[model samples]
Target: MRPTSLEGLPPTDNTEALEPQRTAPARSVVRGFMYAALGLGMMILFAGLAWSIRGGMEPPSTELETAPQTNVVSAPDPQIVSFKKGRLAYQVHCTRCHGPEGRGDGPDAMALRPPPRDFATRPWSHGETPEAIRAVIRQGIPGTAMTGWSELLSPQELDAVVDYVGTLGPLPSQNTEASDARKALLRRAGFEPVEPTIAASPLTFEGLDGRKQTLDQEQGKAILLIFWGTTCAPCMDELPSLDQVAKEFADAPLAVLPICVDEPDDELVREVARTRTKHLPLFVDRTGLARIQYDVQTLPCAVLIDPEGRQVGRLQGGKDWSSETVQTLLRTITSQATDLK
Candidate 1:
């Protein structure tokens, strides 16, 4: 009975042998490697973006990001002390060619064969006004030694320099020194001077038809002297408006005369005819004596000479003569002619 019951003996105590080995640490190591690779890729992408934008390749910052929100009003125009500051600037910068006091004789004059401009002469190297001088200074004279000073000087400084330079020589009236009687006659003739030695000369020129027309002959009439040249693009540009002005004043005693300083008179004559400027009395300056007298080296210059040969107004650059303001000035002068006498 003991041998037959041997197969159903008591249970064994080896339960630990039936469990699997631990693998959690190895799985964790693999997962950590993947995450490290992912982090490295992300960091590379951010670094690449930063490198691309670090240099001049980056676009300008937005106003909100870079600029302040406050409204920055510009500073007012500078207050000037006197003409000496401008004169000093010219002596330092422009004395090479323009000379001290703009007499065209600087220390560097010996270097330049033609030397510099002699502004004291009747035939001025440039125009009379600051604006005209600025244009020349900024743009420079071609085929000459004069270089543009636009970069060297600020606009205000240029203006100051021009104002100082404009005082280089005697004024328009000084070209023809008048006697005491002539001066008295001018005053009696309703001529007024804005600055000393700056009276407008009496208009006396032989017309195209050889008619000896004087300012006295044009009394009770309005005359406009447009100083221009065929070579001047600005002068050509302003022709249409000038035509309209002449037309508006046709019924009135108004004459628009365009005077050109180009030689070989027929060239300008052809230009006037081609442009169809019938409203204007075209005159060509063969000898260029008027250029010497009027100090009109700059082109497209205009002067408003009243019927009594008094210069009521003048303009140095291109403008619409048919403008309302110009018309008002014309009307005012026309109405005041009677009182001028």
Candidate 2:
């Protein structure tokens, strides 16, 4: 007879059917877990690749840190006092009385008795040489609205204005014989005539490689001597551009020497040269003898010496050495030296 319970039934074809029903759901769950694990592994691999690509696009941290501190200081052209600077100075200081073009018909000129000097007329009561004009700018006229600008402007600014004034009129020819005679008379009377340019004193210093050097050794070549210090912010700011100028004249007979007005330390100078100016040759003045000899009272000054060992000119402050105007000036100087040879 057919039994109600499995124990009383004969286990034959129905036994296999019961086994398949119990194990089917467990197999489906195992397959689902394996698929989920594979998807997670693929996501991790893609994330790693994206991170590497972004890291490769950026520069190193050291390069980024030193880039901004390279060179940012820029002054007016040092070779010639620039007219652009002169015009700006005139607008600020002389526009009210002398007018824009220096016609002497400004708003304040009408109220004055003697009136501002008419630069267009070229009838200067004082002398018309650059020296005379510079003197007037520094000392002012005895009876005029013009005040002494020695306190207001730098020597370079005064020179720029003088050059601008000459553009407005035909400057008188300089009387060299008379000037010499006057200077001689003053010397006889126990007075000294003020010289327009100061001569550079002799300099001797040690190089970064621990070799002794002297300015006399560079006599046959035009030398660009830069006085800088590690502690000076402006000096550091001007170094990179100066190095670029040196590179441009690598084949020329120009000696670009950056003299450090600090204690002599080969390692320190080398480090500074490597990071700040890669191509520049460095010299150190341990006793400040070079600074005293060159009369460098300011940081970031440059002294240009001709092939004859005479100082051509001196720039008293920082300048943009890589500017087009500065590059032209250096080229002219180098060309002149080549012509002499």
The most accurate candidate by lDDT is: 2
TM-score of each: 0.40, 0.43
Candidate 1, residue 280: the lDDT equals: 61
Candidate 2 deviant stretches above 4 angstroms: 1-199
Give the clashing residue pairs of candidate 2, or none: none
Give candidate 1 regions above 4 Å deviation. 1-199, 202-212, 338-341
Candidate 2 global lDDT: 0.71
On residues 1-341, what C-alpha lDDT tens digit does candidate 2 reach at each position?
Answer: 66778885556887776987879988989989999999999899999999899889877778777776422222322322255567678889887898876778887999997899877664587987889989898999887778889998887788788776766553332267854754454344332343322223456666766566777777667888899887788888888998898788999979998988864666776776677787778887755556655667888778776564545556767777887656765675576578778
Model 1: which ten-residue window has the lowest total lDDT? 71-80
Q: Model 2 RMSD to the real structure?
A: 15.3
